[model samples]
Target: MKDTFKHKGLRQQLVNILITKGIRDEKVLNAIGKVPRHLFMDSSFLDHAYQDKAFPIAADQTISQPFTVAFQTELLQVNKTDKVLEIGTGSGYQTAVLCELGVHVYSIERQQELFRKTSNFLPKLGYRAKKLIFGDGYKGLKDEAPFDGIIVTAGAPFVPKPLLSQLKIGGRLVIPVGDAVQVMTLFIRKGAKEFEQHEFGEFRFVPLLEDKN
Candidate 1:
Protein backbone atom coordinates (compact mmCIF):
# COMPACT_ATOMS: atom_id res chain seq x y z
CA MET A 1 0.00 0.00 0.00
CA LYS A 2 2.86 2.39 0.79
CA ASP A 3 4.47 1.69 -2.56
CA THR A 4 1.45 2.96 -4.45
CA PHE A 5 2.21 6.47 -3.19
CA LYS A 6 5.68 6.21 -4.74
CA HIS A 7 7.14 8.90 -2.50
CA LYS A 8 9.39 6.76 -0.35
CA GLY A 9 11.93 9.51 0.12
CA LEU A 10 9.31 12.02 1.14
CA ARG A 11 7.77 9.57 3.57
CA GLN A 12 11.16 8.86 5.07
CA GLN A 13 11.79 12.56 5.60
CA LEU A 14 8.44 12.91 7.32
CA VAL A 15 9.13 9.90 9.49
CA ASN A 16 12.54 11.24 10.41
CA ILE A 17 11.08 14.61 11.29
CA LEU A 18 8.41 12.99 13.42
CA ILE A 19 10.95 10.84 15.23
CA THR A 20 13.10 13.87 15.91
CA LYS A 21 10.06 15.60 17.38
CA GLY A 22 9.35 12.65 19.77
CA ILE A 23 6.55 10.72 18.04
CA ARG A 24 7.58 7.18 19.02
CA ASP A 25 4.67 5.01 18.03
CA GLU A 26 5.58 2.82 15.11
CA LYS A 27 1.94 2.38 14.12
CA VAL A 28 1.40 6.13 13.98
CA LEU A 29 4.64 6.55 12.08
CA ASN A 30 3.66 3.89 9.60
CA ALA A 31 0.24 5.41 9.04
CA ILE A 32 1.77 8.84 8.52
CA GLY A 33 4.26 7.31 6.16
CA LYS A 34 1.60 5.60 4.11
CA VAL A 35 -0.90 8.41 3.62
CA PRO A 36 -0.26 10.71 0.65
CA ARG A 37 -0.17 14.24 2.03
CA HIS A 38 0.27 15.79 -1.38
CA LEU A 39 -2.97 14.48 -2.71
CA PHE A 40 -4.82 16.56 -0.11
CA MET A 41 -3.35 19.92 -1.16
CA ASP A 42 -3.31 22.04 -4.27
CA SER A 43 -0.57 21.47 -6.85
CA SER A 44 1.16 24.70 -5.93
CA PHE A 45 1.53 23.47 -2.36
CA LEU A 46 2.65 19.97 -3.32
CA ASP A 47 6.29 20.83 -2.68
CA HIS A 48 5.48 21.80 0.91
CA ALA A 49 3.62 18.56 1.62
CA TYR A 50 6.67 16.72 2.92
CA GLN A 51 7.72 19.52 5.21
CA ASP A 52 6.64 19.45 8.84
CA LYS A 53 4.44 22.51 8.39
CA ALA A 54 0.76 23.27 7.94
CA PHE A 55 -0.28 24.85 4.69
CA PRO A 56 -3.53 26.37 3.54
CA ILE A 57 -5.97 24.14 1.75
CA ALA A 58 -9.31 25.18 0.31
CA ALA A 59 -11.88 27.18 2.37
CA ASP A 60 -9.21 28.93 4.49
CA GLN A 61 -8.48 25.74 6.40
CA THR A 62 -4.95 24.50 6.86
CA ILE A 63 -3.89 20.91 6.66
CA SER A 64 -2.26 20.14 10.00
CA GLN A 65 1.44 19.51 10.12
CA PRO A 66 2.64 15.90 9.99
CA PHE A 67 4.06 16.24 13.50
CA THR A 68 0.80 17.37 15.15
CA VAL A 69 -1.28 14.77 13.31
CA ALA A 70 1.05 11.97 14.36
CA PHE A 71 1.26 13.37 17.88
CA GLN A 72 -2.51 13.28 18.37
CA THR A 73 -2.89 9.86 16.78
CA GLU A 74 -0.18 8.46 19.00
CA LEU A 75 -1.90 9.92 22.04
CA LEU A 76 -5.17 8.23 21.07
CA GLN A 77 -3.41 4.86 20.71
CA VAL A 78 -6.14 3.67 18.36
CA ASN A 79 -6.61 -0.04 17.91
CA LYS A 80 -7.30 -1.70 14.59
CA THR A 81 -10.98 -2.38 15.22
CA ASP A 82 -11.78 0.80 17.09
CA LYS A 83 -14.45 3.16 15.81
CA VAL A 84 -13.11 6.73 15.83
CA LEU A 85 -14.78 10.09 15.43
CA GLU A 86 -12.87 13.04 13.96
CA ILE A 87 -14.36 16.46 14.75
CA GLY A 88 -12.93 18.28 11.76
CA THR A 89 -12.17 17.06 8.27
CA GLY A 90 -10.44 20.03 6.72
CA SER A 91 -8.62 18.39 3.84
CA GLY A 92 -9.42 14.79 4.68
CA TYR A 93 -5.72 14.54 5.62
CA GLN A 94 -6.32 13.50 9.20
CA THR A 95 -9.17 11.30 8.02
CA ALA A 96 -6.71 9.51 5.76
CA VAL A 97 -4.36 9.05 8.71
CA LEU A 98 -7.20 7.56 10.76
CA CYS A 99 -8.17 5.27 7.89
CA GLU A 100 -4.55 4.19 7.50
CA LEU A 101 -4.51 3.27 11.19
CA GLY A 102 -7.37 0.86 10.35
CA VAL A 103 -10.15 2.51 12.33
CA HIS A 104 -13.73 2.67 11.15
CA VAL A 105 -13.88 6.47 11.14
CA TYR A 106 -16.85 8.85 11.43
CA SER A 107 -15.64 12.38 10.67
CA ILE A 108 -17.56 15.67 10.82
CA GLU A 109 -16.85 18.90 8.97
CA ARG A 110 -19.07 21.98 8.93
CA GLN A 111 -17.60 23.69 5.90
CA GLN A 112 -19.95 22.85 3.08
CA GLU A 113 -17.32 23.34 0.41
CA LEU A 114 -14.72 21.15 2.11
CA PHE A 115 -17.36 18.56 2.95
CA ARG A 116 -18.46 18.38 -0.66
CA LYS A 117 -14.93 18.20 -1.97
CA THR A 118 -13.70 15.57 0.49
CA SER A 119 -16.81 13.42 -0.03
CA ASN A 120 -15.54 12.81 -3.53
CA PHE A 121 -11.82 13.00 -2.78
CA LEU A 122 -11.64 10.35 -0.07
CA PRO A 123 -13.43 7.68 -2.08
CA LYS A 124 -11.35 8.34 -5.17
CA LEU A 125 -8.13 8.21 -3.17
CA GLY A 126 -9.17 4.77 -1.89
CA TYR A 127 -9.23 6.00 1.71
CA ARG A 128 -12.17 4.75 3.73
CA ALA A 129 -14.01 6.45 6.58
CA LYS A 130 -17.23 4.81 7.76
CA LYS A 131 -19.21 8.06 7.76
CA LEU A 132 -18.85 11.82 7.18
CA ILE A 133 -21.21 14.38 8.69
CA PHE A 134 -21.71 17.91 7.41
CA GLY A 135 -23.05 19.58 10.52
CA ASP A 136 -21.99 21.31 13.73
CA GLY A 137 -19.36 19.06 15.25
CA TYR A 138 -19.68 20.85 18.58
CA LYS A 139 -22.78 18.73 19.08
CA GLY A 140 -20.94 15.61 18.09
CA LEU A 141 -22.85 12.81 16.32
CA LYS A 142 -25.42 11.54 18.83
CA ASP A 143 -26.56 8.58 16.72
CA GLU A 144 -22.93 7.44 16.61
CA ALA A 145 -22.21 8.05 20.23
CA PRO A 146 -19.76 6.07 22.35
CA PHE A 147 -16.93 5.98 19.89
CA ASP A 148 -13.76 4.15 20.94
CA GLY A 149 -11.77 7.28 20.20
CA ILE A 150 -12.44 10.90 19.24
CA ILE A 151 -10.08 13.48 17.75
CA VAL A 152 -10.80 17.21 17.49
CA THR A 153 -8.51 18.92 15.01
CA ALA A 154 -9.59 22.48 15.69
CA GLY A 155 -9.01 24.21 19.02
CA ALA A 156 -12.03 24.88 21.20
CA PRO A 157 -12.39 27.46 23.97
CA PHE A 158 -13.85 24.74 26.11
CA VAL A 159 -13.96 21.01 25.50
CA PRO A 160 -17.41 20.41 24.07
CA LYS A 161 -19.35 18.51 26.70
CA PRO A 162 -21.40 16.56 24.19
CA LEU A 163 -18.27 15.22 22.58
CA LEU A 164 -17.09 14.04 25.97
CA SER A 165 -20.52 12.48 26.44
CA GLN A 166 -20.19 10.55 23.20
CA LEU A 167 -17.04 8.78 24.31
CA LYS A 168 -17.24 5.18 25.41
CA ILE A 169 -16.48 4.52 29.07
CA GLY A 170 -12.92 3.55 28.28
CA GLY A 171 -12.55 5.79 25.29
CA ARG A 172 -9.93 8.50 24.93
CA LEU A 173 -10.38 11.89 23.25
CA VAL A 174 -7.54 14.15 22.06
CA ILE A 175 -8.30 17.82 21.64
CA PRO A 176 -6.65 21.22 21.80
CA VAL A 177 -8.38 23.33 24.45
CA GLY A 178 -8.13 27.11 24.99
CA ASP A 179 -9.28 30.46 23.64
CA ALA A 180 -6.20 32.29 22.34
CA VAL A 181 -3.49 29.83 23.41
CA GLN A 182 -4.25 26.10 23.24
CA VAL A 183 -2.82 23.04 24.86
CA MET A 184 -3.39 19.58 23.50
CA THR A 185 -5.34 17.66 26.11
CA LEU A 186 -6.32 14.05 26.51
CA PHE A 187 -9.49 13.04 28.25
CA ILE A 188 -9.98 9.40 29.15
CA ARG A 189 -13.50 8.41 30.11
CA LYS A 190 -13.32 6.16 33.09
CA GLY A 191 -17.00 6.31 34.03
CA ALA A 192 -20.10 8.46 33.64
CA LYS A 193 -18.73 11.00 36.07
CA GLU A 194 -15.02 10.28 35.95
CA PHE A 195 -12.40 11.21 33.42
CA GLU A 196 -8.61 11.52 33.56
CA GLN A 197 -7.04 14.59 32.05
CA HIS A 198 -3.53 14.54 30.66
CA GLU A 199 -2.00 17.67 29.21
CA PHE A 200 0.45 17.69 26.37
CA GLY A 201 2.33 20.73 25.09
CA GLU A 202 0.78 23.71 23.33
CA PHE A 203 -0.34 23.85 19.73
CA ARG A 204 -1.99 26.41 17.46
CA PHE A 205 -5.05 25.40 15.47
CA VAL A 206 -7.93 27.19 13.87
CA PRO A 207 -10.64 28.16 16.32
CA LEU A 208 -13.33 25.53 16.44
CA LEU A 209 -16.42 27.48 15.52
CA GLU A 210 -19.97 26.26 15.16
CA ASP A 211 -20.35 26.93 11.47
CA LYS A 212 -23.09 25.12 9.57
CA ASN A 213 -21.51 26.26 6.35
Candidate 2:
Protein backbone atom coordinates (compact mmCIF):
# COMPACT_ATOMS: atom_id res chain seq x y z
CA MET A 1 0.00 0.00 0.00
CA LYS A 2 1.59 3.21 -1.19
CA ASP A 3 0.44 6.83 -1.32
CA THR A 4 1.01 7.29 -5.02
CA PHE A 5 0.24 10.24 -7.24
CA LYS A 6 -3.24 8.89 -7.93
CA HIS A 7 -4.05 8.74 -4.22
CA LYS A 8 -2.78 12.27 -3.68
CA GLY A 9 -4.84 13.51 -6.62
CA LEU A 10 -7.96 11.80 -5.32
CA ARG A 11 -7.38 13.36 -1.91
CA GLN A 12 -7.13 16.82 -3.46
CA GLN A 13 -10.46 16.25 -5.18
CA LEU A 14 -11.90 15.18 -1.85
CA VAL A 15 -10.59 18.37 -0.27
CA ASN A 16 -12.27 20.34 -3.06
CA ILE A 17 -15.58 18.66 -2.26
CA LEU A 18 -15.15 19.51 1.42
CA ILE A 19 -14.46 23.14 0.54
CA THR A 20 -17.74 23.24 -1.35
CA LYS A 21 -19.40 21.78 1.72
CA GLY A 22 -18.06 24.80 3.72
CA ILE A 23 -15.00 23.28 5.41
CA ARG A 24 -12.92 26.49 5.35
CA ASP A 25 -10.17 25.64 7.76
CA GLU A 26 -6.98 25.46 5.72
CA LYS A 27 -5.19 23.34 8.28
CA VAL A 28 -8.00 20.80 8.30
CA LEU A 29 -8.11 20.72 4.51
CA ASN A 30 -4.34 20.42 4.31
CA ALA A 31 -4.29 17.53 6.73
CA ILE A 32 -7.06 15.86 4.76
CA GLY A 33 -5.05 16.36 1.61
CA LYS A 34 -1.89 14.89 3.09
CA VAL A 35 -3.26 11.85 4.89
CA PRO A 36 -3.93 8.77 2.71
CA ARG A 37 -7.56 7.96 3.35
CA HIS A 38 -7.53 4.99 0.97
CA LEU A 39 -4.95 3.27 3.11
CA PHE A 40 -7.36 3.47 6.04
CA MET A 41 -10.04 1.40 4.29
CA ASP A 42 -10.18 -2.25 3.38
CA SER A 43 -8.37 -3.01 0.15
CA SER A 44 -11.65 -3.98 -1.56
CA PHE A 45 -13.03 -0.50 -0.88
CA LEU A 46 -9.92 1.36 -1.92
CA ASP A 47 -11.53 2.78 -5.04
CA HIS A 48 -14.27 4.43 -2.96
CA ALA A 49 -11.98 5.83 -0.29
CA TYR A 50 -11.90 9.43 -1.48
CA GLN A 51 -15.61 9.77 -2.26
CA ASP A 52 -16.46 11.82 0.87
CA LYS A 53 -18.61 8.95 2.15
CA ALA A 54 -18.28 6.78 5.23
CA PHE A 55 -17.28 3.16 4.66
CA PRO A 56 -17.30 0.22 7.02
CA ILE A 57 -14.06 -0.75 8.70
CA ALA A 58 -13.17 -3.60 11.05
CA ALA A 59 -14.96 -4.23 14.40
CA ASP A 60 -18.39 -2.99 13.25
CA GLN A 61 -17.07 0.57 12.89
CA THR A 62 -17.11 2.97 9.98
CA ILE A 63 -14.45 5.38 8.90
CA SER A 64 -16.19 8.74 9.10
CA GLN A 65 -17.20 10.56 5.96
CA PRO A 66 -14.37 12.86 4.93
CA PHE A 67 -16.51 15.95 5.40
CA THR A 68 -17.49 14.87 8.90
CA VAL A 69 -13.85 14.41 9.80
CA ALA A 70 -12.97 17.83 8.44
CA PHE A 71 -16.02 19.44 10.00
CA GLN A 72 -15.29 18.11 13.47
CA THR A 73 -11.61 18.93 13.24
CA GLU A 74 -12.34 22.44 12.02
CA LEU A 75 -14.49 22.95 15.06
CA LEU A 76 -11.62 21.83 17.28
CA GLN A 77 -9.38 24.72 16.18
CA VAL A 78 -6.38 22.62 17.08
CA ASN A 79 -3.00 24.27 17.73
CA LYS A 80 0.37 22.57 17.76
CA THR A 81 1.11 20.76 21.03
CA ASP A 82 -2.53 20.88 22.12
CA LYS A 83 -3.42 17.90 24.26
CA VAL A 84 -6.47 16.38 22.55
CA LEU A 85 -8.65 13.66 24.00
CA GLU A 86 -10.30 11.70 21.22
CA ILE A 87 -13.20 9.45 22.11
CA GLY A 88 -13.86 6.43 19.89
CA THR A 89 -10.67 5.95 17.92
CA GLY A 90 -12.80 4.09 15.32
CA SER A 91 -10.88 3.63 12.04
CA GLY A 92 -8.13 5.91 13.42
CA TYR A 93 -8.64 8.16 10.41
CA GLN A 94 -9.79 11.04 12.64
CA THR A 95 -6.90 10.34 14.96
CA ALA A 96 -4.53 10.60 12.04
CA VAL A 97 -6.02 13.93 11.02
CA LEU A 98 -5.45 15.32 14.51
CA CYS A 99 -1.89 14.02 14.56
CA GLU A 100 -1.19 15.70 11.23
CA LEU A 101 -2.20 18.96 12.90
CA GLY A 102 0.73 18.39 15.30
CA VAL A 103 -1.39 17.92 18.39
CA HIS A 104 -0.63 15.38 21.08
CA VAL A 105 -3.66 13.08 20.82
CA TYR A 106 -4.84 10.67 23.49
CA SER A 107 -7.50 8.49 21.88
CA ILE A 108 -9.71 5.96 23.66
CA GLU A 109 -11.28 3.00 21.89
CA ARG A 110 -13.65 0.56 23.57
CA GLN A 111 -13.65 -2.25 21.03
CA GLN A 112 -10.62 -4.42 21.56
CA GLU A 113 -10.30 -5.59 17.98
CA LEU A 114 -10.41 -2.09 16.47
CA PHE A 115 -8.19 -0.78 19.25
CA ARG A 116 -5.48 -3.38 18.70
CA LYS A 117 -5.58 -3.06 14.92
CA THR A 118 -5.58 0.75 14.87
CA SER A 119 -2.95 1.03 17.60
CA ASN A 120 -0.58 -0.97 15.41
CA PHE A 121 -1.71 0.37 12.07
CA LEU A 122 -1.40 4.14 12.69
CA PRO A 123 2.28 4.05 13.64
CA LYS A 124 3.01 2.11 10.45
CA LEU A 125 1.50 5.07 8.56
CA GLY A 126 3.70 7.46 10.56
CA TYR A 127 0.72 8.72 12.58
CA ARG A 128 1.06 8.29 16.30
CA ALA A 129 -1.26 9.47 19.08
CA LYS A 130 0.42 10.19 22.40
CA LYS A 131 -1.55 7.35 23.92
CA LEU A 132 -4.05 4.96 22.35
CA ILE A 133 -5.90 3.59 25.36
CA PHE A 134 -8.15 0.52 25.21
CA GLY A 135 -10.66 1.90 27.69
CA ASP A 136 -14.06 3.56 27.94
CA GLY A 137 -14.11 6.99 26.32
CA TYR A 138 -16.90 8.10 28.61
CA LYS A 139 -14.44 8.01 31.48
CA GLY A 140 -11.91 9.95 29.41
CA LEU A 141 -8.27 10.03 30.51
CA LYS A 142 -8.77 11.53 33.96
CA ASP A 143 -5.08 11.58 34.73
CA GLU A 144 -4.71 13.63 31.56
CA ALA A 145 -7.58 15.93 32.41
CA PRO A 146 -7.76 19.53 31.20
CA PHE A 147 -7.06 18.74 27.56
CA ASP A 148 -6.98 21.56 25.04
CA GLY A 149 -9.64 19.77 23.03
CA ILE A 150 -11.77 16.61 23.10
CA ILE A 151 -13.54 14.95 20.20
CA VAL A 152 -16.09 12.15 20.32
CA THR A 153 -16.27 10.30 17.02
CA ALA A 154 -19.55 8.52 17.75
CA GLY A 155 -23.04 9.79 18.52
CA ALA A 156 -23.84 9.88 22.19
CA PRO A 157 -27.36 9.99 23.63
CA PHE A 158 -26.15 12.79 25.88
CA VAL A 159 -22.87 14.51 26.51
CA PRO A 160 -20.73 12.53 28.92
CA LYS A 161 -20.14 14.43 32.15
CA PRO A 162 -16.62 13.11 32.58
CA LEU A 163 -15.58 14.42 29.19
CA LEU A 164 -16.75 17.91 30.04
CA SER A 165 -15.02 17.77 33.39
CA GLN A 166 -11.72 16.96 31.75
CA LEU A 167 -11.61 19.90 29.35
CA LYS A 168 -9.15 22.69 30.11
CA ILE A 169 -10.48 26.15 30.66
CA GLY A 170 -11.02 27.65 27.21
CA GLY A 171 -10.73 24.24 25.56
CA ARG A 172 -13.25 22.85 23.08
CA LEU A 173 -15.13 19.56 22.89
CA VAL A 174 -16.65 18.45 19.57
CA ILE A 175 -19.23 15.69 19.57
CA PRO A 176 -22.45 14.49 17.97
CA VAL A 177 -25.37 13.85 20.28
CA GLY A 178 -28.45 11.75 19.44
CA ASP A 179 -29.58 8.23 18.57
CA ALA A 180 -31.07 8.03 15.05
CA VAL A 181 -29.67 11.28 13.76
CA GLN A 182 -27.03 13.33 15.55
CA VAL A 183 -26.60 17.05 15.97
CA MET A 184 -22.99 18.14 15.88
CA THR A 185 -22.43 19.82 19.22
CA LEU A 186 -19.57 21.91 20.53
CA PHE A 187 -18.76 22.73 24.12
CA ILE A 188 -16.24 25.32 25.05
CA ARG A 189 -15.08 25.47 28.60
CA LYS A 190 -15.19 29.06 29.83
CA GLY A 191 -14.24 28.56 33.44
CA ALA A 192 -14.19 26.02 36.22
CA LYS A 193 -17.91 25.34 35.88
CA GLU A 194 -18.90 27.40 32.90
CA PHE A 195 -19.29 26.16 29.36
CA GLU A 196 -20.55 27.70 26.15
CA GLN A 197 -22.51 25.34 23.91
CA HIS A 198 -23.21 25.47 20.20
CA GLU A 199 -24.90 23.10 17.78
CA PHE A 200 -24.13 22.60 14.10
CA GLY A 201 -26.83 20.93 12.06
CA GLU A 202 -27.17 17.12 11.87
CA PHE A 203 -25.12 14.03 11.08
CA ARG A 204 -25.41 10.25 11.36
CA PHE A 205 -22.84 8.21 13.25
CA VAL A 206 -22.51 4.91 15.07
CA PRO A 207 -23.68 5.13 18.68
CA LEU A 208 -21.06 5.99 21.29
CA LEU A 209 -21.11 2.97 23.57
CA GLU A 210 -20.05 2.80 27.21
CA ASP A 211 -17.56 0.49 28.96
CA LYS A 212 -14.87 -1.56 27.23
CA ASN A 213 -15.10 -4.93 25.53
The candidate that wins on lDDT is 2
Whole-model lDDT, candidate 2?
Answer: 0.95
TM-score for all models, in order of appearance: 0.96, 0.98
Question: Model 2 compared with the native: what TM-score?
Answer: 0.98
Residue pairs whose backbone atoms clash in candidate 2? none
Residue-by-residue lDDT tens digits, candidate 2, 46-157: 9999998999999888999999999999999999999999999988999999999999999999999999999999999999899999988889999988899999999999
How large an RMSD does model 1 have? 2.0
Tens-place lDDT digits, model 1, residues 27-141: 9999898888888888898777899999998888899989999999999989997999999999999999999989999999989899999998999889979999898989999
Give me the overall lDDT of model 1.
0.91
Tell me the spans in candidate 2 whose CA falls farther than 4 Å from its real position. Answer: none
Model 2 residue 2 CA deviation in Å: 0.9
